[model samples]
Target: MAPAPSADTLGTSAARARSAVLEEQIREDPGRFRMLTGDRPTGRLHLGHYFGTLHNRVRLQDLGVETYVIIADYQVLTDRDVADTLTEHVEELVLDYLAIGVDPERSTIFTHSAIPALNQLMLPFLSLVSVAELSRNPTVKDEIAHSRQSAVSGLMFTYPVHQAADILFCKGNLVPVGQDQLPHLEITRTIARRFNDRYGNGGTVFPEPDALLSRAPLLLGTDGTKMSKSRRNAVALAADADETARLLKAAKTDSERHITYDPAGRPEVSSLLLLAALCQNRTPEEVADDIGSAGAAALKKTVTEAVNEYLAPLRARRAEYAQDRAYLHRTLREGNERARAVAETTLAQVRTAMKNHY
Candidate 1:
C-alpha cells in the first residue's frame, strides 16, 4: 500500500506490526514500544515448538523495541511435578534459547524464580483478577484439559495473572502471542484497565499490555495432531539427522500414493509439506509445485534434509553451549541483574501508586 520502508527502515515498520494495536502505537508514541513473551521451562523445544513465536522476537529486537524472554520455571508446577528434573529443564531451556540465537545481551532473558519483586507484583495482580477470570483463561482451560485435571491448582488457575505481572513488571506494553493466546492477553488488558481504574488516579502504574500476534504458522505434529511433547508427535529442535529421518518416515500421510496439500482432506500430507516448507522458508503451495519436479519420495527426502540442515547449526551450537555451563550461568546472572533492576523500577512505581512506599 505504501512505498515500503527500505530494508534498513523495514525493521522499524515490522516491529510495530507485531501487534495490530501496536500499528496504531507508532502514530501515537513511535518510540515507546516494548515486547514480552516466553515459555514454561517444562521440556525441550521442538521443531514445531516456539519457532513461530521466536522468529518474531529475534527480528523485533533487531528493530529496537525492548524485548524480554521470561523463562517461566515456576509455571512448570501448575501442570506436573518434575521436581527432580527442574534444574535440568531450566538449564536446558536457557541453553536452547541461546542455541537458537536469542542473544541475551540484546534482550533481557531471566528466570521467574530469580525475581522477587516481580513475584510480589503477582500477588497484587492476583488480588485484582478473580477466580472466574482465571478459570476462563484459554491457556489455563487448554492446559487443564490436556492435563485432564480433576483438581486444578491455584497456581495453574492464576497463570494469566502471573503473565500480566510478567508483562506489567517490565512495563512491557507489547506481547507476541499465537492466536490461541489472544484471549489471555485480553484478560491481561482487562486487568491492567481494572487495576488502573481501581489504582491509577494520577497515572497508571501498569501499561496495558497489547498482543503482537505472530505471523508464523502453527506447526502440526508428525501424526497430524498438535505438535506437542506430551503427544510424542513433535520433532525436537535438537533432533539429529537419523532422528529426523525416523520421525519423517513414521509420520502419517494420506492413503493416496502421492503427496498433496489439501489440508482438510489430506492433513497428514499437507502437514509434511508444511514442515518441508517451513524448513525451506517457503509455502506449502510452493512446495507442492516443486513436488512435480522432485516426486513424492524425493519430496519427503528433500523436506527431511531441508529441516535437518536448517537445524544443524543450531544443534551444533547447542552442543557447544551445553559444554559451557559457566557461560550460561554468567549470561543468566547478568540478565537477572538487568531484569531485576528493570522490574524494581516498575515495582517502585507500583508502590508509589498504591501509597505503600512508606
Candidate 2:
C-alpha cells in the first residue's frame, strides 16, 4: 500500500557492494564472470561504438568471459514510426559486429526479437518493477529528450524491465556500461533482488548483475558535440579508407593551432588526440607530447592515419563477411538457438520460482 521507492534509490547500496565484489572477482578469476552488452540496430556502428564498448568486448571474450551481445531491435521501435528498413539495419549491424571482432564462435551474438523466451520473461519482470519507479528512470528521460519525442509508448516506459529480462534471461552477472547508464543497471539489480525475495524458494532465483565500468575516454563528434548517428558526427566501422580519411580531416579544431591535451580548455583538439591515443594504445597526454608544436593540422593528420590503419584489417574482414550473406544468416541462426536455449532454461527457473511451472 505504501509508495514504491524512488528510481535513484533502487539499487544504490547493492550496486556499490556488487562493484566491490566484482573488483575482487577480477583479481581472483575473471573467467568466472558473465557479461551482457549491446546496442540498438539503428545504423552501422561508429568510432564512438568502437572506443566506447566494442574494443572492451573483444578483450573480454579473449579473457574468457561468457559474453552475450544483443541487437536490441525491439527497443528501436520505441520512437521509429516506419520499420520498412529495419531488416537492412539489422543486417548492417551484424556486419559491423563481425567486422569489429565480435566473434560468434567466442561470444554469443543474437538479436532481441529473435529470442521469444527472452521476451516472455519480461511479463513477470514487469510485476517486480513499478510504474512510478519506471517513470523516474533517468536513462529513459534523457533518451526521450534526445529523440525529441513528445509522446511515450508503454514499451518505452517499461524499457528497464525489458533490459532486466535480457540480463536475467542470460543469467548475466556482469554488465559493461557507462556511468550514465548506472541507473538502468541499478533498476535491473532491484528487479532481480525483488523477484528473488518474493518468489525464490529459500534461495535467490537470479544473480544481480554488477557494473564493469569501461576505461575508454568518451569520444566527441567532429563538431565537438555528442557523437551519434542522427547527428552525422559518427565514423561508421564499414567506411572505406578514403571515407575514413575524409571524415577525420573535416573534424573540427580550434584556431589557436598548437595541440595540447587540455580536455576542458580544448575539447576539439583533445578529442582527436584521445582517438589517436586509444587507437595506438597510448595515453592522450603522451600522444599530445609526441605531437608538440605540430599544430592542429598535424594532429588531424596523425589521427587520420592512426584511425585508417587501425581499421584496415577490420574493414577487410567486414567486406568479406558482408559479401557472404549466407554466412551472416547462419551465424545469427546459431546464435539465436544458443541464446534461446539459455533463455528457456532461465524462464523455466523463473516460472518454477513463481509457482507457475505446473
Candidate 3:
C-alpha cells in the first residue's frame, strides 16, 4: 500500500476521484448506483440550488438511479435559535422541489425529523468519529466562520455524523456533491469503512460512497457573496415573475458603464451576467458578448427579464400545488413511510453486524 497523503492533499484527491469515476459509470449503468442528495429546509431554494444539485438530481433519477432526497429539518436547528419557522421552511422546500422537477414517483423525498430509524444510526456512527477529526473538517470550519456566532452548538459541530447516518441509512453509494462538500463526504466514507471493518464478518455491511460532482455553475448572491437565505441575498425558487424582477433590479452592479464577464475584476457585473447566462442556458461569455458595451442598468434589465421568464412556469405550478395543501401533506407522508422502510432494513443489518440485535 502507498503512504497516505497529507490532509490537504487527501481533500483535493477525494474531491476529484469520485467525480471522475461516476462520470464513466453514469453513462454505462446508472441503475447499478444509488444516490443521496438534498438540502437543509431553512428557506425556499434559489437559483443556486437549481443549478447546483437539483438539475443533476433529476437527471440521475430519470437515468434509473435509486435516489433519496432529504429535507434536513433537524440540521436547521444547528445554528438557528428558534424552531417556529422550520415547519414552514420544510413545506416550502418540498414545493420548491416539485416546482423544479423532483418527481415523488421517481425519487423518494423525506424529512429528516420524521425518520426515527435513520437518526438512531447516529449513535453508533458517532462513536466511530473522534472530536479531533470533527473539529478538523474544513467544511465545518467554514460554516462556523459563516455563522459568525461566538458560541456554536454541539449539534452543529457533529452534524457531519448525522449526514453519514442520512446516506448510509439508505445504503447510498453515489452522492452528488460539489468540491466544497467533499470533506463531509470523506468523513461519511471514513465512518462507513470503520463500521464495516469493525463489524463485518468477511462481508462488508456498508459501502464507501463516492462523490458525483456536477458541472453546474455556482450562482453568486446578488451582493456578490455566496447566495444563501441567511444572507438575505437569495432569490427563492418559487419567486413570482414580479418578485424575480424586483430582486434582480435591486442586485448590486459595478459603477463601470461597460458590461463584461471578468469575475475577478468586476464581480458585481459578472455575477449579474452569470445569472442571466445560467437562466438562458448560455455561457457567461456569450451573454457578456451579446450585452457588449451595456451599462449596469442594461445588464440588470436583461437579467431580470431572463430570470422572470425562466421562473414563470415554475411559479404557476407552485401556485397550483400551494392551493392543494392536503396533496403536499400526503406526498410527504407517503414518502416518509417509504424512506423509513429502507432505513429500517439498513439499521437492522447494522444492529445484527454489531451484535446489538437481540
What C-alpha lDDT values do all the predictions have? 0.79, 0.86, 0.87
Q: List the residue pairs that clash in candidate 3.
A: none
Best by lDDT: 3
lDDT by residue for model 2 over 1-358, one digit each (tens)? Answer: 9999865456554555666677677757877888899988888899998989888888878777888999899988887766787889889988988988888998998989989999999888888888889888889888777764667777888888888888989889999887778889888999999988888866988998888876667899988998898899988888887888888888999987567899999998999999999889898899999888878878988998889899999999999998999999999899989999999999888877788433
Candidate 2 global lDDT: 0.86
Give the candidate order by descending TM-score.
Answer: 3, 2, 1
Worst 10 residues of 1 by lDDT: 7-16
Quote the positional error of residue 277 for candidate 3 in Å.
1.3
At residue 52, candidate 3 shows an lDDT of 84
lDDT of 1 at 276: 83
Q: Total clashing residue pairs per candidate?
A: 0, 0, 0
| Candidate 3 weakest ten by summed lDDT | 9-18
- Candidate 3 lDDT, tens digit per residue, 1-358? 9987887777667667767878788889988899898899877888888878887898888888888999999988888777898889888988887887889998898998889999999999999999999999989998888774578999889989999999999999999888888889989999999998888877789899988877777678888788888899989888777787788888888787867899889887888888888889898899888888878778888999888888888888999999999989988999999999999999899889999423
List all candidate RMSDs to the true structure: 6.5, 4.4, 3.0
